[model samples]
Target: MLRVLTVALVVTALVSPPAAGQPPRPQAVTSLLAGMTLEQKVGQLFVTYVNGQRADEEHPDNVRDFGVATPAEIVAKYRPGGVIYFDNDLHDNIDSPRQIAGLSRGLQRASKIPLAISTDQEMGLVTRIGPPVTQFPGNMALGAGRSTTDAEQAATITARELRALGVNQDFAPDADVNSNPANPVIGVRSYSGDPKLAAEFTAAQVRGYQQRFLTWSGVAATAKHFPGHGDTATDSHTSLPVVDRTVEQWREMDAPPFRAAIAAGVDSIMTAHILMPRIDPSGEPATLSKPVIDLLRGELGYDGVVITDALDMAGVRQKHPDARIPVLALKAGVDQLLMPPKLGEAITAVVDAVKSGELTERRIDQSVLRVLRMKFLRGILTSPPVDPDKADAAVGTPENLAAARTITDRTTTAVRNDGGVLPRRPKAALVTGWGENSTRTLAKLLGGKALPTGATPTPEQITGAVEAAGAADLVVVLTSGLSGSPEQQALVDRLVATGRPVVGVAVRNPYDVAYTSVPVWLATYSYGAGALESVAKVITGEIGPKGLLPVAVPGPTPYPLGHGLTW
Candidate 1:
């Protein structure tokens, strides 16, 4: 039985239709398009969430009935016009899920501009797309793709899944230049530390998502962590992360991929919450900076929508609580504000800023026009009302899973299998797995007793696992990182010296494999189960291996790029 199952994609050809060759912009924008006051345009600049539980406070009757995004009522009373998605689970079922999309449709029925809903769903692990759905590796995995083609496959598969789910905006393909290994929050989510490779793959991912243009009905692709999220040790979720890389370093390392993505016609750009005093010197996060947005909009020539990361994050609310971030973000030229249900409060803030001459109606209009443009391009502005019920058969179909597996097959690279560690033609083989998700996938694929080797392996544990495998004449190690910490490196070294043709799989960032000379080095690039199953197929000879290292596998020494085997 194949551990990796391919499911056909079920396209909801009806709900939200694509605007092919949409004549630049559709004249058929929503009737909501009909209600326009200059103040509403400025108000539409901020997109906040409505906590359903808070609905009762704003309208007591809302709880008794479907008031439509009750949490939004507090702010909707003010009328800021955009909405964003976070970790909120919109449904209880995976195959047939009833999502907040329904609620969103309900709210848009009342908004000024068609509300744009967004999520940080770069890959399956980063989202709540329901179960039995295939997930690809994160940006780290895509960066590890043996070639630009690999990244494209990963991107294409990812795009298909999101489109099927009725999500119009994906805050994916992290463009941040992550040179620092210690960087938290963005480790496996980034493409590469090398700007050139990152740029190439970023473009690849764009193509992947774009290929499904018709299927997505104009889904917006967002390349984020702009100005770079890598090189910072701090996580913005806890407090504001400060990037110390000077403007010069950013120009060379951090800016290329994002520039590439924008040029590729990405529909939107997301602002990072980090502060780089080097760039602004004023101590403001990129989401609230005139300089940052100006650089992205003016210098980069990104004319599409500009959105902020979740405003509810600690980085924005804690650091600059009283500053009116949503208002400043728009004045700074961001087209959409994310996740502030206190839409009324945010609108009042923006209204004050404009009245005080701190912001102009023109500035607000610039953003509103862009928001309208996207909805127009998406065929949602002037299109028919999308009944959420029409979406039932469209989410997570077999065809979509096949697309994901196809991408995994294309992207998963088998760099080395010297000594025939693979095609373990022998009756049985011992396999050791790694990471929470990957370990599970490998076990399912290999179909035998497998042991967990942890992130970094201990010499004793590795030796023990290898010895156990030696009994079967082959030892396969699937690892993202070595475990057993300070004393564990020696154990891995000993396992290699066994001359058992140990097969090693790196989950992402082939950097860790540089130090050891494991005869077989496979870089899968992510924690997705789909990638793991692909790797198992490579070893079991179910599929021929063709992936090469897209990035250098750094260790004490780095493996040259294009390092992989041909079947």
Candidate 2:
């Protein structure tokens, strides 16, 4: 039985290993480290950002206002092992993949070692790469569709596109189980509430990236926010979430997907900023807890790179001195320090820690060796820098878009169609929640009035919308985060009270259905233009709905997990 295997995994995870098994360092990596200074070795542990725009240019609205550094400047001074790309880097010129490739190449050329060019391209809502890159449905949709092959295909395309754009590391396929429907951050980013299904999907996604090479140079996939960010209701971006599960409960519910990811030979596991009190009684988040990280390495036997989540997150930042958090994380067994608040301060702190006997040089070498070994294995050490001329042609091709469409089409699920009110090209009114109308394809499809009822609509607004939509054949309420927003629930309740047939479209969160009694309901796990358009097509019977429900909706007669209907 699956439970037996899961139990065995937990038992193994609980027993700490004597030491993390270090992979054989490549000769180049060995020679490079042998000749490196302590500061250079410490620099190899950081993966910071680079500005695509001019250093003199004002910080873009989307980018963090952290101290800016040119890729070349970072290499010369900070000597970071890697550089992470963000929307600010390419949002201005996303259509030009060659330019992105040029950025990656320039950064690599400036580095002493081949930098691990990385991004947070989790495909759907979390994608760092902008439009034209295939925006496939996210993890919740993949879980709803119940197809491992589709999940693998999506990830492969993601890897293919990212590698084409000269990014080799993708912090994606969020392995968290969405056990708590109200979880603020992990909501639809997670695959399923069921650990077994999430684990299978996680493994499939890992295989997609690791097994399928976009370039001969390949890509590395990271299974992220480890020890599960699912059960907690807090967002680690703003505060530290305490996961109160006992060790056994975590092994059963939270650890399976990670175990499966490790089994699939994942390239990296990013630590969560959340604290697991049961796993380690010491009042420390997993990011700085030796017992927790040791459990992952010693018991789980994950020898691959152990990356930390963004250090700028409040969960860790508010807990430690800004300059010292990176050092503590490195001491806690993190190999890659991602997005520290101050790049120079973090590198300097680590160097000072070593000199002050707070951290040993041997300990630093252990992490640096692991980092070097990964770079070597990924072929970044020997592979030529990404060719700018070939990047645009390879990335965002029609073939890749078609693959993304195929995945999206299969993932749009119909959760409810009471009295068969769907699959009709009805005169429908479009009512939206926050950021719901990035594309007006749904409104354009219905040839109806577009109304913003607000994220939490006023009763007057809802009633007015109901009156406004009186002439329409159907009322389509596009709701987001309704499960957590009572005001949104009131808006949906009033709309459903209208005489017209009401179709509840859970725009971003599938659990939005639990808040309303709409005659018909549908769930689009992503707010991407393609995903929104796919929902419109599925509703109009242009395409059939194939996705199953990845999470349960609470009610007296609740829609169970995997409950999906097709006309």
Candidate 3:
């Protein structure tokens, strides 16, 4: 029976609900905005991007030059009320999942209304579709495994593999609160530095991406970069990152996970080109600020759908240029402008600013009636087409890689073992200041020997990994920032001066255990092969390291902010 109602709606989105549900009736968005017009309600406030599925043939996974327009000329001339996908439209013609469900059923069969097709899956390491799906273990390893039912079963298996590839929006649970452990783009895509434990794992990843298909047709989650790119060290995807705190230290650390992702009913939030300037001293960067979208709709009451974040970043493209960032992100109230970098000069500068009154066709029909009321509360206007052969049985389903290896074996963290040097099985030698398939998967999970160093390692590859760590018995470095290079702290000081039991592992910044003085340290906050197979089954003990330090690693171990140990 449709596989027992998709297994009782994936076991009711794997438990963990408790609150926030309401939000869907706007009377089919007031009778579809009383039959739209003004250039189709300014193309329903644009959620643009095509990543080319044949636009005069330029494939190689398209996103970088938008292949000059083809999915029937972006659905017959920018009728984009939504469409996001990337990684060049599912690897330019062959990323499977039935060729991205026939390129999202040919852009919702050349849209007129049913569109909102988004992606940026946010599976560890910001995956934008490419793989047999299910990657999980993101948001600082679910805030180092303080699981909210493993962040609502990894956003209900990444919203049931983005609804079998027709992708009904998921920018994702990055409700940023990494709280600057030198945040250059929300470390471990944040789930903590404790703002009520990143607002209880951002309301358990917005009830695992908007209540995992409660009775069907779902997805839309978002809650991103808003009001806080987690205490920025600048990288609003190239430049503007300021956040100088103060609305009571940003309501005690970046607005409590965007007020628990708008009380967990998050159908979309996004914003944040970072520049709080103490909550808008008119420095303008909360995507062009009207006191930061009126403090997310009059002091965080957030009536959903704000979006912004990628108006071709350089923090709002080095201060607005390609026809003033979609009419100053819809005069800073922003319902959605997402990837706008001259999508026909931002829809002819919002239809020449509503024919020169500088904006106001009833403010573009109140942001295209909040983007057609979140595509009619995510049913994507009565969903149907996009069964490109049930996307190979709804992508990577072994019940979604056993719910992405049970949330990457509960987020791997053993923060500094010190002497017991981690469930030892050694004969190992796997060093990597750069990933060669994470030095051949932690050297075939420790039957070891794979030294590949290049993320700046040459003093004869750090004296050949200090003479292959003097014929290994134990020496596994794997890093992605040990102090981001002096040849990765001269290859972790020549593999901890070859006093062999050295461990290290930080694979993609858990602040590289504050520049390694390693006696043993681990943190698979993402390099993703299911977080390096849960850091090789927590160093061969076959998983037994319930991860903890969800941010705070400054020089010296005592790792703080929820550090982990567990033998």
Candidate 4:
């Protein structure tokens, strides 16, 4: 039955809608677009970042940028269509569910049109909202489990929590195929290396996010970094990375998940910052390239809201100044300018472009209508405010956490189990690893001593861990990003030399197994609480490893994509 469903989905994805047959615009959206002024219409094209948890609180960044100290004032002055939240040390928009709910209600109160509140709640390493929001081991883990049902359930839980907090849109389900192991930005964020697998999981997640969960409406799902960011070695946040895949190669390797997303009727598609010179020789990144955007619209028939990936990033700003990026993105058929560096400059530039005949108000209307249609379709206009008092009851419930744990349990893959080293009880176990929290959790779960290593461990630390390994019958070393870290690999190698029956666990990227040789190798894909618990259960024979390899591990003896071992 699952095989039949998978085949049906892939078949549907391959068949694109005719170019001339577009979906009819909602009359409410049309009316809303007609009533809006030029400034308001231009404002609808932008989704900016603002600081503070409350709408009324004074923030330095808001004060300097918008000349407004509060979120409400900024919203009133700029009239942006949406707002995105980030949780960092300097400025945090997420604290607790009730706090976030209050912030969402306050923002809605200030806006004439309801705002599409969004965040990058992609759940593994890229998670923005923390506990008591249920954290699943991310997309790669879902791929490892090879269960479309689990994938949809994870997204369903994510959407439910976000809606309770009054966040209407989610920038998630990274559609990039992680074909390149050296990729810095999108490693485990991607579902699988195989295009078909990635497409299936991407489609399932899109459906999960858009489907109504319980009492709350669905949050808008975004299939991100189109056409694909999987094969790039560079991080677009710092600089522009170019993918050199020919048009045919891109169609086969990079375009499947995006096609699946469009077929599933994803609410939005976020453009990548990297340059695909093969597609558009003009050297513009996909975020600001007409040919690239046309491929999504003209070829894929994705007429939904097209958003840029953070215009403030160095990738988009490399060719043009900060002010010109919004206009170029709009000109390239991008509907929403996400996180522009200077919001005021971006708005002024768009307004000036319209007045100077560089861009038509109709062009602005085209994007605005799309954004308004999304808001209306997603029920953002009718139900903007959420109950702050009931948010705690909805988010991170025991049922949600249990579901997350079950999914993570299914994702623990035993890649190498030499001599049946796993599913055994060791007299004394030593837990030593790069992640402090993960190592500590594993140590506690195993009732063993933990010697945590930094991301880059010193010789003395390695020696100390080795010396500690001698006292235990079993040693488990947690590795992360080992493909690039020789020192961490050396640490694992040195532990194996101790003849202590070492087991290497990849808590981040599964590619760590390729960099080292260990008698027993297991991959959890994420070091989150649920994943850590799952790994512990697999090690102690409480549960067998049920996960398959989502991506191939290249080493002296390469493991194929579907490789997994069970007791």
Best by lDDT: 4
Order of all candidates by lDDT, from best down to worst?
4, 2, 3, 1
Error of 3 at 370 (Å): 19
Stronger candidate by TM-score (2 vs 3)? 2
For 1-567, candidate 1 gives per-residue lDDT tens digits of: 011010001112212554553324322233333456756766667665444422232444333332443644533554555555444543122223345446555555555445565556678346545444446666766655546775676566555445444456667777876677666677667776778888887877776765533343446678887777877888888889888777677888888998898767777788888888978988888888888888888888888888888787877775555438787778677888876534456667877887888888767766776776665454444444445675655545687667667766766677765666577644555667466456656766776556676766666676677677666555666654443243335545566787766777777555556645577777777656677778788877888776666555555656676676756
What's the TM-score of each model vs. the native?
0.80, 0.90, 0.36, 0.95
Lowest lDDT 10-residue stretch of candidate 4: 3-12
Better of 1 and 3 by TM-score: 1
Q: Flag regions of model 1 displaced more than 4 Å.
A: 1-34, 37-39, 50-80, 87-95, 98-104, 110-112, 130-137, 140-164, 207-216, 246-248, 341-344, 387-392, 416-418, 453-471, 487-501, 517-519
Model 1 error, position 225 (Å) = 1.9
- Give the C-alpha lDDT of model 1: 0.64
Question: Once superposed on the true structure, which residue ranges of model 4 sit more than 4 Å away at CA?
Answer: 1-24, 212-216
Q: Which has the greatest TM-score?
A: 4
Q: Per-residue lDDT of 250-348 in model 4, one digit per residue for the tens?
A: 899999999999888788999999999988999899999999999899888888999999988888889888999998988998999998888989999
Q: Per-residue alpha-carbon lDDT of model 3 for 1-567, expressed as tens digits? A: 243234234333433432346654444355456766788778777777665554343444333444443664565577777877677523343367787788787777667567888877777778777577767777888888887988887787678768777888888888878877878777888888778898888888788777743324458888887777887887878888787887788878888888887877787888888788867887778888887788779988887688887777788777557678789878888878877766767777788888999898987887777776676566676566678788878878787788778878888898877778778667555555577777877687667788788678879888988887888887777878667577877788778877778778887768788664777888888876777777777776776898888777777544678878877
- TM-score order of candidates, top first: 4, 2, 1, 3
TM accuracy, model 4: 0.95
**Whole-model alpha-carbon lDDT for candidate 3:** 0.75
Collision count for each candidate, in order: 27, 1, 2, 0
